[model samples]
Target: MKQLLLVFTILFSPSFSAQKTETFKIKKYQIAILGDSLKESSGLNFFNGKLYTFNDSGNSAELFQISLDSAKIQKKLNTKLRNEDWESLTNDGENFYIGDFGNNLGSRKDLKIYKIPFRDSLVLDSTKTISFYYPEQKDFTPKNLNNDFDGEAMIFLNGKIHIFTKEWKSKETTHYIINPENFENQAAEKIETFKTDFVVTDASYFEDKLYLIGYTKLAKVYLIVFKKSENDTFFRETPKKYYLGSAFSLSQIEGIAVNKDGIYISGEEFHSPLGIKKGQFFFIPFSDFD
Candidate 1:
């Protein structure tokens, strides 16, 4: 009887693992090698047909514009504002928003987004500040990067700024919204909550589609695409998720931008018990997924 049970376990274990495992292949191409200043490039966006990115915590408040042909920094936009953990970037045709709310520990009270009026050039002096807080969070204690209130990805949608939280404790994402016109320190409206099981690093919206990029605790990278749903709400429809790759090959992916050409991704240099990698820039053609 014991031998029979062991044989059953051996025969069924592989099937069980296969049943639980879901993965999608992505065709990736190397774009460039990011510089030291952008070793922690945590946010990415495309403005005026140019790709831009910036470093996250412990870095300067500067935005680097990269040339697609050469895949090198062509210009750097300097801001007088402090970079207190800027984590995401978004734009609304005429203006740009920089999210300064990387509360990994969930103890932050000064969460804000800087809005810069833009047309022909990037302006830093004429920027406005939009502040917000979660209405559901009552605790101000630091939890050491394992909290639900932590957020690093956001995008502009339907006249409002939608923020996606990088949940560490629950592995779920909470959707929130803030009015761009209202800059007062008000409570963000909770839209909905869903299980992502990965930390969202950056988000982008284009052509009525939502694109999000993130990584797992084990360094597995993923991309989630949400098509337009009823009334234009992202949660009303099921999302299509695709596995990008592993950190051993891609490092700590932290940024994503999708356009007519393809999907662009960047990662910060990573050094862990598993492996070490440098800051990288990569692209995956839409044909591979579409």
Candidate 2:
């Protein structure tokens, strides 16, 4: 009888010990205040030692650069391009890409991305805009367009643009690559598709790795890491989730960007009795994520 009890204890104890060995890594992030009451903080990008972001729905759709150390708006430049539905922002070494192709209802036939030159010394008083369209699909009025595709996150790589769709009621995402040089009424080619258990909001590529961010219905935020595969594909590695605590009491979170310094995220809004409050941005040190 004692021997039987000892055997059972060993069996159960090993299982418990294995479970104890498995742990989720939780990283801490610091919330940095950009603006108090921003109407719609859509796209965020950190480039050339400055952080840039823009408001979606606003009269003066200007791109503002903030100092990384002080977190203060260093320069606010009015963009020549209009912000009809700007969703995501990314930058290569030479130019900044803004995704004006937001199709929430999946009914936007005229989706486009604007490429503006990255000027360091000169204040961007005026900018040139170039547009590109998806070649495969034309009419936005698909029977199941909601489940098809939409644009939210973009990354510029190797003289081409890579766009990722935001899965609004689904757990899958589609990726497309476009050569802006072939924007003469040509369509962007579909590259690959990836599915995740979580709903992705934004993504950024840095140091040969892709980082994806998602917001749960409970207002929780999760970070997913993927390494580039052999054929220039992205494969999911280990995923870590973090609770961003709370931002202004509202839950809908969006916008993510990465630089050599750290990872940055912005929340949409929180529900309040008085009214809806503007979103805020947070930064996580790159070392913490590493």
Candidate 3:
């Protein structure tokens, strides 16, 4: 009986069994061009299998819809919301939220966001706008290398709006939660923070995880993954470092969005001596991460 039991244990044990050991491998994706000369392509979101993106700075503030498979622009919707330093954008099932909160000088106080209904024929007059402001925090300039505190990335999750800062010179990220229902005088509660090796420009949530992409001073763009904990906080779960490579020929990569299809990245042209084009979009297929 002892000999029979030992044979059974050996056959059923995971270590001794013939079952294959599954290993997770990082996959490379082919970057497809959505558009060129985007004039600071800042935000990206997907709706019903199509891709939509907007410019961060410029007049008119056009929202562009593109075909993901063909990488072609299908339609351009001119939003009523003026682009006063438009930074980042996201969607919440019914409406699209555009953040006009690009406070670079660290002086402006009246930051705002625009909410537009998702439609096939959205006109400039049909858009709605909402404004928000952060409470005063003693008005101090960023003295250290990591003090730039303006953002272009805002997402609507669980009926609340969550904002992430675009650190111009910081390796750490601050998360704030806001009440979407009460836009005016919405004091952002600093919920949590995370540190990164690269400057985080933009982020998006997909598959129950948050993915942040940013560029380093060395001109390398990286992707960092974070998984949410039970306490409603997010913690970095990916390995130490993972490089997504450069965004086009430019280095200042900003926007990132993930869906069931794959990962999408955008860039604001880094300071170049050769005078490179301003903004562009690139994408990697979802299967690459699998």
Q: What are the per-model numbers of colliding residue pairs?
A: 0, 2, 1
- lDDT string for model 2 (1-290, tens) is 00011223323422111101112222234365446534356667878767777766443557778665534677877666677777778887677777787665667666777767777732355344555666655656644324445667777777778887765445556777877555454466777766554446677888777777654333345566677766556754444434444333433456777788877776655553335545556677867655
lDDT of 1 by residue, 228-260 (tens): 666556877778777777766776788888788
Show model 2 residue runs off by greater than 4 Å. Answer: 1-28, 36-39, 121-130, 135-139, 142-145, 236-251, 272-277
Clashing pairs in 3: 88-152
| TM-score between candidate 2 and the true structure | 0.77
Alpha-carbon lDDT, every model: 0.78, 0.60, 0.63
Cα deviation of 153, candidate 3, in Å: 1.6
Better of 1 and 2 by TM-score: 1
TM-score of 1: 0.89
Which candidate has the highest TM-score of all?
A: 1
Give candidate 2's error at residue 121 in angstroms: 6.1
Question: CA lDDT of 35 in candidate 3?
Answer: 52
Q: Per-residue lDDT of 46-163 in model 3, one digit per residue for the tens?
A: 7666677777766457887866654456788887667888777887877788888877655556677787777676645656667666663456464432355666677777887788
lDDT of 1 at 72: 81
Candidate 2 vs 3: which has more lDDT? 3
Query: Can you list the residue pairs that collide in candidate 1?
Result: none
**lDDT against true structure, model 2:** 0.60
lDDT of 2 at 232: 57
